[model samples]
Structures are given as structure tokens and as C-alpha cells.
Target: MRCQPERGHLVYIWTKNNQFCALCDEPSGVERDLCGPCEDELPWLHDQCSICALPLLVDGMACGECLQRPPAFTRVETPWRYDFPLDALVTRFKHQGKWPLGRLLADGLARHLLHAYGEGLPRPDCLLPVPLAKRRLRQRGFNQATLLARWLGAQLQLPVDEQLLRRTLETPPQQDLDAATRQRNLRKAFALSHQVELRGRHVALVDDVLTTGATTQSLARLLRKAGAARVDVYCLARTAKPGD
Candidate 1:
């Protein structure tokens, strides 16, 4: 059950699962794992671009960059802005090997996606987690995107193809690169697996966070070339554009 907060207190409480808030370690007084205060403090996104999901001055308007040159993906759905506790949670989940934190974040994202689907967002035929390069996968011992995709697929009852997309090159992290360089670095970084047919299929690309969207765009282009009819991106958070 959902708890609507009023003046920092839970207005409606249901269930007593005794789950503790991942952030503050306080008892979660609601049905969900997060306590009412933490839930209320999530960095929710609003007034964003329809195509890129970038925070905008006004809602339902495409960002200037998107209007001039739209990316391969047709739409993006992200529930939170990349900031504060959300950023800390993602960093811990991705780099520190915190599986519980990752699972919690995935659960929240799945709920948001279900709500969006209820509000008429088109569901994709299959889900593809943004793949990790062989070197990184070996170094990390697991792919965070793959884990998130698995959880979300289970929650949504959607098919997930982990082998459909493969990263061909070990490019540097896009976080440190500028937009132009990021795009150039990822130009030939992805490939479609052999014997995979995407013809007339809609695919959702899943990832942990979307910063500049270079990686997603690269994979989306490859999917389109392999005959995907539509590409949509799903992520936990979206980082605001620099200086926006």
C-alpha cells in the first residue's frame, strides 16, 4: 500500500512489514521498503523534455538539442533526477557491490514503469539491458544493468534478451567526456548478436542512469539498423545537462 505524507508524517499507514529505510535506517512505516520521509524526499523529475527526459523550464516541450537532432531512441522514461540520496544510492549499488541497494532501486523503477504503462506508455516487445564490455564485465564480476533488467523484467512480466546487444569496444567512461567526444568514442562500440531478429519489434533499453545518453543512442542506432521499429529508454535517474 502507498502512504501519502503530510507535514513529514505518514498520513495513511498500512501493513507492518518492518522494513527499514535504506537511507536513514529508520523503520519504514509504510508497505514499501522506504519510509514515508525518504519516499517524500526522493528527487522526483518533473517538467522534462518528452524525447530526452532532460529537466526543462516547461513541461511537455522538447529540448533544443532534441529538436535540432533527435537521438535514436524515440522516448525516455526516468523517475528521478540524478542528485542527492539517489546519486549516492546508485554509486553504492554500481561500484560498491551493494546488491540490496540495487534491488531496492530497481523495485522503485519498476513501480514507476507500471504507473507509466497505466498512463498509456507503450510497452516494448522486449527489454535489453545496456551491455557492458568484456573487460569491464570481467573486472566487475557482474553487469549492473543486467541485474536491473532482470529485476524489472520479472516485475513487469516482460521478456528480457541479455544477449541481443553486445558492447564491441572498451570505451572509457562517458562521465568524464564531453558530449562530442562521448558520441565519437561510442561510434563503433556496439553490435547486434548473430541470429537475433529485431524486425518490426519495439525494444526498451534499460540502464542504471542516463547522463549524456551517448551510450543509449549508440545501442539504439544499432538496434534500428537490425530492424527495430521503435526504441525507448528506461533508466533509474537522468542527470541534468551541464549548466542547465
Candidate 2:
């Protein structure tokens, strides 16, 4: 699928400069160069599920899954749902080799991070992207999570440390797995880099989408072990109605 038609407006809002659409370089809507519908429809992460960051409820406690077993990240935020045109946006970036979408995704994520974490969240000194395996990176020609981290870091004015985390294990895709299987696959998949000292410093982990959150959980657990005082996740989109 192509990138969503409204994606240009979202980018305009985040960049806040009069930038021609990257895909077409055509002039966008007037003023901020955004049409009314696109601007209105830009979904911000609002009163939502506390655990999965979905959009069904607010003022409620954690979801059942988090109660049974919570994720390792201190908190999470996502501006859009992993459905509809947003899903298409992800595919365009990852599989279709449309790298510009990373900047668009990062813009949404930065706003949500500030909204959800607010003052309660620690200001991270560095951004640690959930690393990808060598083979996967070679096939994709890029790590989408790392791309998001870089762009998010620029927007948030945080440092993006590409070497803060390392991948010790590589497993098959988690898309076909259940929650338990997903967790098992990612276990020990992430290893903190001794080359950098993360201890006592807050770190933000970034990724494209959080499915079961197993990968993020595993990475966060490791970051905490490696002297990171606090860990948070910044993802572009999260699944809606997580139970499915």
C-alpha cells in the first residue's frame, strides 16, 4: 500500500516549516500548508489504555496482561493505531523502501512522548533504538527503529546513541507467534553495549510499532540492568483494542 494521503499534513505539522511534500515536492495547504481535514484528523495519543497505549479507555488501570506481567519499559506512548492507513504507512517505509516515512513517524511519536510522560518522565540523555539483527538489517538495507530514533532525537533535542545497545541473538519474525512465543523469541535477543556507560542516565528506546511489546520489554530490561536509571519507549503506532 502507498503512504496514506494525509501523511504530508502530519509531516508539515511536526516540521512546522513550510516544506513541500517530500513525495511530490508540491505545495501543500495554505498557512501551515495543511488542509483542514488532514489537520483535524491527525490523531494524537489521548485518554487511552494505560498498558498497551490503545485508545478505548481512560482513567482505568493497567490492562489484564500488564497486571499479570508488566512490560519492562517505565512507560510507553504512541500517537496512532496500528490499523488503517497508518499500517500502510509502516509498510511503505519498511518493505517498500520509503525511508522518508521515518521522519513522519518520529514527529507523531515525539508529541505523544511529551504528552504521556510529561513531567513525570525522565529526560533521556540518549536514545537507544531496539536493534535489528545483521541479516535483517542487510535485507532491509536499514533499521527502521534506528531511523525513528534518529529523527525523534532530532525533534526532541535528545542524543541518539546508536551503539548503546547490541543484539546478541536473532530470531524469526514474531508476527506469527502468540504472546508467550513472542516473549520467548526476544529473550536475550538484546545486549547492552559495554562500549558506552548508560548507568544513571535516562534512556529512550524507539521502535516502529509495539505489537506484544516483547522486544521492547526485553530491551528495557537490559537497559535497566546496564546502569540506565530509567527507560522509556517511543513508538510510532500501537495496536488498538489490544486483546484482538
Candidate 3:
């Protein structure tokens, strides 16, 4: 079942050159809706697993799980850790349909990806959003992943293939399941639409957040088996290990 939006949800609209900070509501002093200080205070992921982007104590190290079982995706790029005001912001956007907040975060993610590309990160040929189940899509009235992908595509000048991949199963909410159960729940949950040829092309999966990673892992494995040259994940934030 879906959760209700928090009482602290903020309502704002996007502007081209001027906007108020979504967090503090002060003049952002930038193109985006987040002020410099609030952006700095965000739970930025510094040192993390190179592949999964799981937060870590040191840099350039893989988490124990990834070392044992590597994910099919090449790497994950995210801007913040799932905590505090970020959690609230994401909840508002996803649950309450506050698209402007989603836009704010998507813009931040686009900037992050731009910096990464500047630092030699390989850009994918297209962006694919992690599809939501039909039932859930109706309930929520939108797919956050699709919105992020479109926004990022516009910002980065990449094509977004919304029909390239799809969710074929309606599983329980992943947040309610354990890691192992999450993986099990996703079995055969996704399949390629084959509307576009992905052969030899690199693609990035867009989503609002990555938790146990089972969803992306499942989708990545499918893409790899279908002859995709590479797969990557781009999201607004990565959650710490359960109970961390």
C-alpha cells in the first residue's frame, strides 16, 4: 500500500533563472531551486561502492556484498544519501505529486551527471526509467522514474526510451521486503519491450531512489542478456545499509 505524504511538503514551481530554495525557501541565487547552503547540507555520498554507490567509510572500495556478487549494471551515479530533508523532499514529490520538488532534485542530479561526464564518466546512449507496475502507476498517477528520465534527457541532450523496458509483474512494495525477498519478488518482474534495438548501445536506468538495489540489478541483468553494451543507474539518492 502507498504511504501518505508528509505534512511538511512544500509546493513550488520551476522557473528558468530565478527560484526560491525548496528546503529553506530563501532566494536560491542560482538556476535551481536549492540554495548553496542547503545543497551543501544535503547528504552527499562521498566514499561508496564504485558499482552500487552504497555509502562507505572510505573511498575506492567495494561493499562486501558487491565484492561477492557483482551487479549487472556498470555503475551507479547519485547525488545524495537517503536521509533527513532529502527523504522528506522525495516523499513529497513521489507521494504527494509535488513535481516541482522532483524537478529540483532532477536538476541537481543532472548537474551531478554533468560533472561526472566532465571527469571522464562515460555517457550512455539513452536513458531508461525503471518502470512501475500498472496498478501502482494508476494509484500514484505518475511514474517518478519516467519524469526524472525525461527531465534529465532534456538537460543532458540524451534520448529517453520510455518503451524500451517495462514492468511485467506487480510485486509488493520493495521497501516492505527484506533484501533477499526484494530480489525474489523481482524475478520475471521486468522484461524488454524490444521497441528499440539496444544492441551495442549503453543505457542508463533512471529512478528516484535506490534501496536494496534488487530492482536495478534485475533490470540490468535483463539488459545485459539482451546484448546491451553497458547499463548504468542514475538516481537522486542512495540509502545506507538497512539499520545503518
Output the number of the lDDT-best candidate. Answer: 3
Task: Assess candidate 2 and give its TM-score to the true structure.
Answer: 0.80
lDDT of 2 by residue, 142-216 (tens): 999888888888878888888868888879988768778988888778876765676688787888888777888
Model 1 segments more than 4 A misplaced: 1-17
TM-scores of the models, in the order given: 0.91, 0.80, 0.90
lDDT of 1 at 88: 93
TM-score of 3: 0.90
lDDT of each: 0.91, 0.74, 0.92
- Note each model's CA RMSD in angstroms: 7.8, 8.1, 8.4
Give candidate 3 misplaced runs (Cα > 4 Å): 1-18
Better of 2 and 3 by TM-score: 3
Q: What does candidate 3's lDDT look like per residue over 151-171, in tens digits?
A: 999999999989878899899
Q: On residues 42-72, what C-alpha lDDT tens digit does candidate 1 reach at each position?
A: 8999989999999988999999999999899
**Quick one: ranking by lDDT, best first?**
3, 1, 2
If both were scored by TM-score, which would come out higher, candidate 1 or candidate 2? 1
